[model samples]
Target chain A: MNIYFFKISTLLYFLATMVYSVYLILLKDDLLRWASRTVLLGFVIHTLAFLSRYVEAGYTPVTNLHESLSFFAWMIIGVLLIAGLRYRIKMLGSFLTPIALILMLFALALPKEILPLAPVLRSFWHPFHVIFAFLGNAFFTLAFCCGVMYLIQEHQLKSKRMGAIGKRLPSLKVLDDLNYYSLKFGFPLLTLGIITGAVWAEYAWGRYWGWDPKETWSLITWFLYAALLHQRLTVGWRGRKAALMAILGFIAVLFTFLGVNLLLPGLHAYSNW
Target chain B: MKEKLNLGLKLNMEIIVIGLNHKTAPINIRERLAFQDSEIEEALRRIRSIPSIRETMILSTCNRVEIYATSKDIEKAVQELKQFLSEIHRFPLERFERNLYLLIGEEAVRHIFRVASSLDSMVVGEPQILGQIKEAYQRANESKASGVILHRLLHRAFHVAKRVRTETKISNHAVSVSSVAVELAQRIFGTLEDRVVFLVGAGEMIELAARHLVSGGVKKILVTNRTYERALTLAREFQGEAFPFGEMSVGLKKADIVISATNSPEPILTSEQMIRVMKERKHRPIFFIDIADPRDIEPEVGDLENVYLYNIDDLQKVALENLKDREKEAERAEGIVREEVERFVRWYQSLEVTPTIVALRKKFEEIRVRELEKMLSLHPELTEKERKSLEAMTSAIINKILHEPITHLKEKDEEAMADFYIDALQTLFQLPQSSEVAKEEEDARI
Candidate 1:
């Protein structure tokens, strides 16, 4: 029953994501609202399904790629729902729903593969490291959305199209502010995630830092976002420049999450479900 | 009253516009005819009592004084307007009415739109009038004097003006009509550099015209007003020379362009006066513009060869020609206005559906409660706590079921589906249409 609900919820998220993408192009606020509401509803159902899994499993519920990715998507949605409500930027859902859906779809495609943890894996700091790290990446993802909008708005303003969408989009100043704070919040959490990962690595493999592709790429993502925040705050280079940097950082995050696991063999890759 | 279906059931409604404009009256005449801001309330009271006048707006500007009104008896409103003008100025009614030109209905709406958009301005497509109209609308809105029809009309007029500015070439080339006149002068003379321009008055319009000419590279400006001090002040500001009124002929001879704007009622320059000046300049083509009312320059001066004399009327004709170019872009402007109008109308219509929705929700909740109560009464074996739990379960189920429909109704208010649903709810519940008001009052009491 739990599996069926998750599957249905994820499917609706995918459908809603597609509708939102179409709505961005269609430029209808009403259609966009429907898409966002649908996505939010899916998120709520997905959260319930995840809670049910946790109830049955009697742990933090992260054992393999399937569970981890599903949890990651859920965390992203939770952040989005909270931020969206607080900020009243319903438009962000159009950017985020697709990303959440894609991650969850990947989670679903790999079957139920909750591996029993080794005695070494069962530690106090393990869940905090993984969850906070993923949550930090969630913040970075939101920054990426704001960044993309900033670039589009800047381009449209330069071209003097000044369309309804151009007008409706948040100002460059607001987008810059969002990017700045998202990074400010995410970077420290990421540093903690990396630090905790390091501690976990030292405990499990007798090394605090490994230049593994995932770790290397995650560091690279960290540096890019850090540079963006520094440039924005120190040099006051914002708008399109900051946005491009954010986009690059988000791409690096994607590579760290998916690419390192799938293409490059890594210790984190435990997904032969 | 015969119904005029073509005018949207306004056959008995006569659109009477009684006013004095720059062309028909002098500044003294126009100022006397004008209504001060403080006097508008009393004027509105007086005008509304004048037998058949239904709606009225007093538009007072420096260049124009107009009373726009709809009346069952057109003569009554017209007579009142004339009498008010006479009483205010201590002039005869016959004298005041002679200077007023009346336009009705279609012409009136078009005129107001054009005036608000600056198309009907003394200098066509001048942007100042647009701001002035906005000020007038704001004042009217503040007073709560404007009704539904006037509100829509004024709102539409403002939208139309914005449309004209955005989608048309009217505001693209020239910002002011005076500047356009300068542009024409530049076209005629090839360049204003090393040319002497004579400003015959130190008035604001004359100052603006002189400034435009100076910016266009006129080498020298000769200022000659009736008052020597005024001419000297204008000359000192523009770094030009001041010629006394006695030496007007000398200034005319040296000037390649002569711009006259004064408050004088009599002809300042006659054909005889110009013929003498022309001989001294050896028939040099002098561009003459008399922006003053009541014939500052004799009309016959325009008939003189090598003298390009343009009075306010002639200048307006040029403006009309320019307006023809603006008319080409009117459809594009109307498209913008129509789109904005639809957007505002949709938002307004949505406001109407909100009460109906609230009523529907109340009716649904009532049904849910009644059904829950009946179900609990039938279950005798259930403990009080168990019955309470059942009630909670049933209530949650009811709320969850209603959620999608209520959300759908709120979000899809634009679709007219809400109206149908509202009507259905009213029919289904056999609820009174007045239930929303009563419910609100009842809630307030609670």
Candidate 2:
């Protein structure tokens, strides 16, 4: 919680991700391995930093958008590492690590001068709402990675620029399968997050759903991913088309988390940094 | 100079390739050499009977017949294979030797890689050769003729072939002998929609030839098989007619191009039969291609005017020409194979030194233990905790002492000093030495 270690780890994570991105371009799998190790090391340091913050603050770091987003990013890294380990996809960390580093940077940039969580945020629903939202978003983020890989691979196959990494990348079929399953896993968690957030709102603010910017954007994001899963299963849409739709849904999730929280006024505006 | 390590594993044994092809001794030789899927065990038995053959696998495709084997005595293996061929085909080996080409060591490795990658295939970059190689390996594996070295070499060759197909443009286009026939049809007839293709049999080769013609815009395909129902079904796919065996000559006259593949005891289409068709067409050149065993088209038809009688051998020549065009890409693929081969060989070499290194470490530990026991006897008055600490200190000291030497021995460059170190260590310790250990150490450096 020296916060300095987290900052340094975040910087290292950024550097590692960048190195891995270049490694992919250059086909340096050894360097990619090094980058993976570095990011995993950075995650360890980042975890220590977060634990220190939890001890200092004496509660779960989900009081405001800044704390929640920081935790959101930390959980995303955990999610990514787990997914990467399970799938044995090394290059994916190159993309997702940058997202984690950026989110952490944004966390550091938040006004740390403010006091702890307000009295209104002190509820059991608060932890559930934030935890579910962050985890659901993490799954969606992985779906996003699969989608991006799918599109790149599909385009390469179509235009036939299929160079080294293009050849090394998994087939469009595999990427589509990853995207489909990621969304399938993500949708219900997102629904739970939304339901919890709604209940928490009703308990604290005397309202269940206010159609606030964050709430509205979250619903839109939910609907998009929902439509994606629906269209894939019922309509038999898959491959590049499904990948593109999942990507679009993640973009909506991004807007709900970042863009709406920052750019628009809402009932949940107090949480914005 | 590196020490003489057990470089035998890395050593490329001669690939004793003894089998007839389209170019070599004709269909008679090739068919005689061809082993059926079930009869491969018998073929392996006959192959193993050949002197000095360490490993063997028969890859008999329609275009070429090849035997891949590892042999220390290349000449003896070749002679044995030659005798086997003579015994099987009942033809003198001297007649086919001129057409048979022998590749040893690196050339053999390169040839196998090319064959597996489809570069040596009748169709450049065709995927069928990979499957054929896999089938050959499977048969060899099941029969227990292939050894560990061959198993690794072949699997690595397959991996290399896959890498080439994925990383290069080697397999981007069709260049099969049948594909050339298709190409020629497209060039001459403009479109297959107006042209008629008369397929003379229900054989797979003839069906493939007909498929090429059909894809080339052949409007009508008249099929004449021994079985009229089978011919009718084939013709129906292309919206054409199925004529009876008796009406094959009539079907030939109707067909602008004829592709004949049959297993007849005698020539099905004679010069006299073709002469009548030539007179009916007023000397219109009928492109007749015979892709068959014993040849469905009469060889004497070449004497007749306005008759283009081309056989499987001739088509193979065209296929070879197409193969030549891809030699540049094949060279690039060869470079990849060479790199992978070296890497695999190096990895195998490293595996050899590991056991030796472990043994050497054990010897050092034995000496360390003896020294520790002597020290404990000298300091018997030391306290229990003090004695325990001394043991830890001594083990750490031994580890520190051995670390540098062990590290140096494990270095990639250690093969250069392998002989000197092994000899010096053997002399200093009065240890029993083996040439295999030194040879293994030398192989690891490369």
lDDT of each: 0.71, 0.72
**Per-residue lDDT of model 1, residues B146-238, tens digit only:** 543345456666766766775565654442467656755653344678688999989998888888888888878889988999999999998
Residue pairs that clash (backbone atoms under 3 angstroms), model 2: B4-B439, B5-B439, B5-B440, B6-B439, B6-B440, B192-B217, B192-B218, B192-B219, B193-B217
Across A1-273, the per-residue lDDT of candidate 2 in tens digits comes to: 436766877788888878888887766567877888888888888788777777787777677766776777778788888877787765678778888888888887877643667877888897888888888888888889888986776554333232445555664545666787778778888899999999999998899998888898999998898787777666456665677888898899888888887899877777876
What is candidate 2's CAPRI-style docking category based on DockQ? Answer: incorrect
- Give lDDT tens digits, candidate 2, residues B64-112: 7778887767888877877776776577777777777777655666667
The best candidate by lDDT is 2
Clashing pairs in 1: none
TM-score of each: 0.51, 0.50
Runs off by more than 4 Å, candidate 2: A1-49, A64-66, A78-95, A108-115, A149-188, A191-195, A198-212, A219-245, A265-273, B1-27, B34-89, B102-329, B336-446
